[model samples]
Target: MIWDLFVLIFYFLVVFYFGFHFAKNTQKEDDFYLAKKEIHWVFLLLSLVATETSSLTFLSIPSLSYKGDFRFLEIAIGYIFGRTIVALFLLPSYFSGNTISVYEYVGNRFGKSPQKTLSFVFTISRLLGDGIRLYVSSLPIAFLMERMGISISPEILGIIALSILSFVTIIYSVFGGFRAIVFTDVLQWIIYIFGGIFALGLIVNQIGTTTLLEQIQHLETLGKWKVFVFDYNQTGDNSYFILFAIIGGAFISIGSHGTDLMLVQRVIATKNLVSGQKILIGSGIVVFFQFLLFLCIGSLLYVFYEGKSIPPDKVFSHFIISEVPSPFLGILVAAILASAMSTLSSTINSLSLTWARDWEMDKWFSPRILSLFFGVLLFFASLIPYFLVETWEKGILEMGLTIFSYTLGPSIAVFFLAKDKQNLPISGFVFSLFFLFSIVITVAIGIGWKLSFTLLVPIGFGCLYGLVSLSRFLKKN
Candidate 1:
């Protein structure tokens, strides 16, 4: 236990050192938010991966495979396709101007009213979505503390864990800004990937390679290895039907990668358009492989436990606490922290940047102060999940994705409208947003209809686009 604590302390110190080191160079607005537009492609690529990975990816992805099969990969395939579209179609407009907020593209076309409206929606959705992410990140920490014989209630422990993470993430984000985040993200990426590899190695060592192969073969007999879903009948009941998964995944990627400022900021930070495009497309491929690694880890865990029943969300963390050795256990915990903090810091910085640029909050406060403020807001937001845990039944990944789906579709729809040669009417844009939200809210509350969370983005995109187009046609006639 002492050695484990030492490892964690050391990790924190190293991250802190990087934060303060970058603070000296972050003297300007561009330096703070866009990293002076000087970051290398490799760093940007890894940072983009780390920011999106979150603890949700580290924890919840394996759970998906543990509970089901590899059908989730279909969504990942869709991610690649979606990013490719962003690179080809949407990115050109972003690069055409020197605007700070991506919504400025909308502002330039339609007006500031729609631009700020989209930014506001993005801010709210990002906060709620990442609040859930913050809560999910705290779970392993709380679980680890409990295993270490801490006598506190899990709820209090979760808050403590969340506070510690938020503080460390806020410090660097406030001081070092986006550059610091990109650098630390590279480090965090290494730690978590290594941790995943280490865990996989140990599992293989215990199972014996030959027996592992035999066991996998046996598991395959039970359809555990199934990946593609071809049956259309399963569309309503299954989220991973290949067609739905791919289309939904693609739209989700478009919303997340193309429109969300958290990621768009990364693309904007790259040295040039080509560099940005490289990382955007490359990240999808890297993520597909990353998901495969974790999914395989979950499948093997299933084999290791001889198919014993375990809650999918708890499977990986439970295994680490029960089976992993001491110093390595601490290292894996740090790995989880690495994943969590990377996303948290990025969230703080992006939220700060968006508020400062989009809402003109910089006039009232410095960027660092805004960073501090949002960090506090996010910490409080993250705490809400603890009270609602009994009611929210979806896994962390699905819930986080659902929260994102709410605003992502409308946001992406606006961007699609912005790309057209004809300018969309502000009234039409406003009406479409209303229509999109009403349907999503109704579907979300389980009011007389059922839909897979995956379908939300496409539904939102179609609704918003269709309404805006109709309004445009009426105006033309």
Candidate 2:
């Protein structure tokens, strides 16, 4: 245990070293935000994979697969199609504009009011959504604390974990800028993937090939390996319905990869249009395989535990702490931290970038100052989930994705409206109203209809587009 803790502490220091090393080169705002537009495609690809995954992918995905089937892969398959569209259509516009914040396009296609509003929306959504992610990432730490006889409430532990992560991430991010983030993300991607691979190998080595095959056969018999859900209901959380998965996944992917600045920021930071497109499309394939790895870990875990009852979130963490050997266990915990920080750091940087660039706040505040400011907000925002865990029944991944879909649905519609060159003949006030309505409908009203959160984007877009078109037609008449 002592050795493991030492390794974990050493890893954090290494991360800080990388961040500080890169800080010297970040001379201006553009360099800070876009990495001087000099990032290679491979680093961008690794960073995208690392940033898009949070503790949710590291911890919760396995739980999801343990309790459910591999139907989530269907959504991953849809991700490939969704990003393909973004690469082909959205990348050209983003690179041509050369703006720091992607929302600038929203301003250009819509109006200045909408641009500022979108920035505000991005800030709030990231604060609330990534806040949940920050908290989820800390769950394993809470487990670690408990085992070490550090008796504390999960809420306090969550705050402590978030603080530690935020502080270390901010130091490098404040200094290193975008270049540091991309490069560190590549390092983190390797660590976490190694952790997953190592854990899987340990599981297989213990179980032996015969036992592994038998377990696989048993899982297949139970239909646990089923990948597609043809249900017409469309209301369930994991509905793998053919059209529902593909269409909803496409819209969500487009919304996230294209409109959400957290992801778009990465692609835009790449060298040029072609490199950006390759990175965007390649990430989808990588995610598909990554999900496969974690889900298989979950399945093998099911075999290891012999189907014993375990809390969904605790499954992966429990194994690492109790089963794995010393130094490797420490390394795996570091990987968990890597997964946590990758998203948190990106969230902090992207939020600062949008506030500084989109709202034209550069005159008032530097990117580093703005990053520190938002980092504080994101830290507080992360504490929210400690209180919410009781009410949230779905796994961490589902809840996070749903919150993202609801909050960002309107923003996605606005992007689509911009793309199609359809003028929204409405005030920012009216747009905000419908935007809130989309969230209300998805969470509150969709309850009765049983609408899955996956469909929220397309539904929200359709509703917004229809209303805006009708108003425009009436004005013409």
Candidate 3:
């Protein structure tokens, strides 16, 4: 037990030291935000993949497959197509000029009003969404502590985990800037993926490959390997119809990668647009295979447990605590932390950069102070999930998506309108405003409308596009 704790602490110390070591290289704002525009596409690609695949995905994806099947992989296919569109179309606009923030395009097209609004929206969405992510990541730690004979409650354990995660991540991110974030993210990407592979190897070794394959084949006979959903009404979170999945997937990709500053920063850091394109598209492929490996692991767990009842999110963590032994167990926990800190560190840095760059703070300590401020905010925000655990019965993945859906549609719509230089009207703004309010209505008022959260992105974009067309028609007449 002491050795396992040492391994975990050693990983944190190494990451912190790297961050401190790289801080000396960042001499100015450009280096801090863009890594001096010298980051290679491979590191950027790995960082991008690692950022999106947060601890939430690491811990929750297996639960998704255990509770469901491979239907979620369809969204991944859409992810590839959507990123291709971003690479071919949206990225050109960003590269056409020196864009420090993705929202700069909005400011140049519409005005400060829309640009600031979208940035605010991005900050809020990231805070809530990643807060939920922080909470989900702590679950495995909580389980581990209990296994080691710790008597703390789950909520306290969660808080302890978040505090430790925030402290370690922020220590490096504050000093190391973009270079540190990218390099650490690459390392984290490897650790977590290796954790998944190690877990699978353990399973295969225990049961023998042939027996595992036989069990997986049996599950396939029971339709557990199913990937596509045809019916519209039947589709819910993690499952989608063909058309809706593609459309939703594309729009969400645009909203996230195309507009969200956290990801856009990575792309803009590359030497050229071509490099950006390669990284963007390559991440899609990597994520597809990554999801498949985790889902297959879930299937193996299902068979190993002989179909015993387990909570959806707890499946993987329970396995780690009850089954995984010694140093490997420590490695798996480190993987989960890596999944978390990569995303959290990137987010904190982005938030600070957006404030410093967009808000025009020239002081050297502006980004650092902002990083500390946001890190603290995120730590407290993470506590919300622990309190809501009983009330929020949906799986962690769905919870994260649901929070994103509230603002993502409007955010995406405004970007599309800005791309065409369309003059957004007051009504258009109202329509965008409704997108945020509708979530409250759905939850609080129980409105008759039953639209799935997955479809919100396309619907938001379609509405804004229609408004833009209508305004142009009236002016022409």
Where in model 1 is the C-alpha error above 4 Å?
234-236, 426-448
Sum up the clashes in candidate 3.
Answer: 0
CA displacement after TM-score superposition, residue 24 of candidate 2 (Å): 1.8
C-alpha displacement of 463 in model 3, angstroms?
2.5
Say which candidate scores most in TM-score: 1
Per-residue lDDT for 112-186 in model 3, tens only? 666666777788889999999988888888877887788998778877777888888888988898899999999
Expressed as tens digits, the lDDT of each residue in 1-477 for candidate 2 is: 788889889988888898889888887988999888888888999999999988889998888778877888888988999999989987788887767888888777766777887788778888888888888777777667776788888667767777887788888778888889998999999999999999999989989999898889999998889888876763445446877887888888888998999899899888789999999999999999999999999888888887588887778888987888888888898889899889988988999898887888888998889888888888889888878888876777888887777755677777777777556778766765666666666666446665677777777777666777777888899
Weakest lDDT window of 10 consecutive positions for candidate 3: 438-447
Q: What ranges in model 2 sit over 4 Å off?
A: 233-238, 427-437
- Provide the global lDDT of candidate 2 against the true structure: 0.83
Candidate 3 local Cα displacement, residue 179, angstroms: 0.8
lDDT of 3: 0.80
For each candidate in turn, the TM-score is 0.96, 0.95, 0.93
Top-scoring candidate (lDDT): 1
Clash pairs, candidate 2, are: none
- lDDT of all the models against the reference? 0.85, 0.83, 0.80
| Pick by lDDT: 1 or 2, better one | 1
Of the pair 1 and 3, which is ahead by TM-score? 1
